[model samples]
Target: MSAETPGPRRSNYSSMPVAYAAIGASSAPDLLRFPPAESTPYEETLQLGSGTERFLTAANLLMTWGAQRVAGVEVVDIDPGEPSEYPGVHFTETGTPELGAAREELFTPEGEAYLLAGTTASFVVGSKDPRRILVVTTVNESNRLGFAWGDRDEVAGYGEQQLTVEIREDSTVWAVARGFTFQSSTGITAGLKQRAHVKEAVAQAQAFLQALAPGAALRNGVAKPADEPDENDQSADDQPSA
Candidate 1:
């Protein structure tokens, strides 16, 4: 269920250095192949335990912004209303419609709110400020699920982050996060900002991996048997009377 190829130079993405340049390059062998000129790239991949369930769980967390949430960053979804005019292809459906619909129904409410191209979200990282970005590309193939985004001029640098989860032929599920960025500041300030950015990126990537590791699915939406009590669940005795 691939989306339409994005149109060139859409007005909504003028703020990015080269909008959509890194669209589908997130999982590429080489990150440099499609990044904006001169931007530095980074990537991290975690091997999730093998299974179809693991892949779906990881993908669900990703679509719901699990990485940012687990890393202690706040996510704010920016609504664009119906017939969204934001940049990039807007479809989130992947693989065949049946499979895509199944995943969507499982992860999102009403099967209509999964992340898609043109969707926008802001990551509020501490008191500094929120970084808003627009999705530029998405992959919803049978074995792979991922999405990439471009900076929306809300941050100090222009860049993007791509997140994906895939199941190999052997049924091994892997989670990956990769992106490119260049500080907009100059001289000494730029150096400091770049280092900080790299640190934050790596931290968030690790959080993403941790969110999908073994035993993570329970908290992430995988159902636990009704007879078993979740450690995090509050017992009736612990609740105050309303």
Candidate 2:
């Protein structure tokens, strides 16, 4: 037990074996995950409803959808367990749902359930009628909350891809999606296609909140801002009708 004693000098056990798999695994996700095909960053801001209380509630709920796992495209299992306490509770006992299945997936679970980071999936935004799936990755709501896949999964994208919906106190909200980086002209062209779909999805989300706001035109069930002109005609109504 001497500190410097050369007792039992076993060459086999003296040096530890190199583990290539574990060592290289660190950057595996980065190599496989979605690479910036182009640099097409997108950011848009729009005024929702002007109501103080109501607007905040609606926007906040949108954020909560991700946390509670309220939204996502999931098929009902034959054994639809107990009814969820949350109204319109849609969840799957197994399998990770689409990234933005409902409005957004606020909370990312601890397990990857066997998936690649860039594995694309259809995402839906807002609770708009017919939550359609749009272009998106297979990751969860953790993106908006600034979470990454590799955090939970051993091998996942560095988690660079993201979409954020910031709801301010002023009732004006803004959204941003990290577009791809451009390496070449072909990559730029491809990135535009992806950006196009992302833009549409975010817009739908904005519209959903716009309609849900208090000042939205409840008369016709269409969400119209108070400042927005009448649908019949935005023209000068000041002149007397002929």
Candidate 3:
């Protein structure tokens, strides 16, 4: 499934509900299950605060694209030139969460579930080049909130990422991030670049967890970098004065 544009690089968003390379994989809670055999896979999980309030807070933040913002990743919507031609809901370049607009335009029912299916945007991670992606799957159930995206027109490789927050029977909340990537580009530097790719992917997931609870220990037990800032720390402006 592909869409034609004026440029050389085409978009994969035209397929809507199944735009990504590995479709329907992120829809399930366990991403480890039917893995993309060719791509390298990684999973990261963190125990967020327990209870309903914590779960709701994290869900709302994720639904609003707060995780990307916290990861220092810039998300810009690609203008399809003709808005009407584009399918499903899409965000503005400002990356603002317009759930009301999505509900009204996309005919999404008014309820707690918030799945922005078929959203397309460009993500700029660090100083590296931008990677275009489409939202292929989203889970917005009573006890879970998550979305998955796939890389589009990337020169280095193709990949899919799933970021989700779930609550257990005992009300213990958890954050899970997982993804797989397969590099296609070839060159003397390609091997080194792919290694960076995995690291970046892991770091991206870690950022999502850290954003929710800075300085919180990872369930995988990976050590945090020495210079990682504790966003949970109260700034001077955040402190109350006498």
Best by lDDT: 1
Residue-by-residue lDDT tens digits, candidate 1, 120-218: 777787896777777666667678877777776635555677888889999899988887666666776778887787676667677777775655546
Q: How much does candidate 3 score in TM-score?
A: 0.63
Question: What are the per-residue Cα lDDT tens digits for candidate 2 across 77-162?
Answer: 11111222111111133321222333223221222122222222223334533221111222233112221111111111111223
Question: Which of the numbered candidates is closest to the native, going by highest TM-score?
Answer: 1
Query: What is the per-residue lDDT of model 3 for residues 1-242, given as tens digits with 9 covering 90 to 100?
Result: 11210121234666432223444343333345435444556789898877665665566556556577566677787432222433333223343222212222111112332336566778887898887886655665578777777776654546777888888999888888877666555689877777888787788788887665533323324343222334453332211111
TM-scores of the models, in the order given = 0.67, 0.29, 0.63
lDDT (0 to 1) per candidate: 0.59, 0.28, 0.57
Model 1: how far is 49 from its true place, Å? Answer: 0.7
Between candidates 2 and 3, the one scoring higher on TM-score is 3
lDDT of 2 at 68: 14
Predicted structure 2: lDDT = 0.28
RMSD per candidate (Å) reads 8.8, 18.2, 10.9
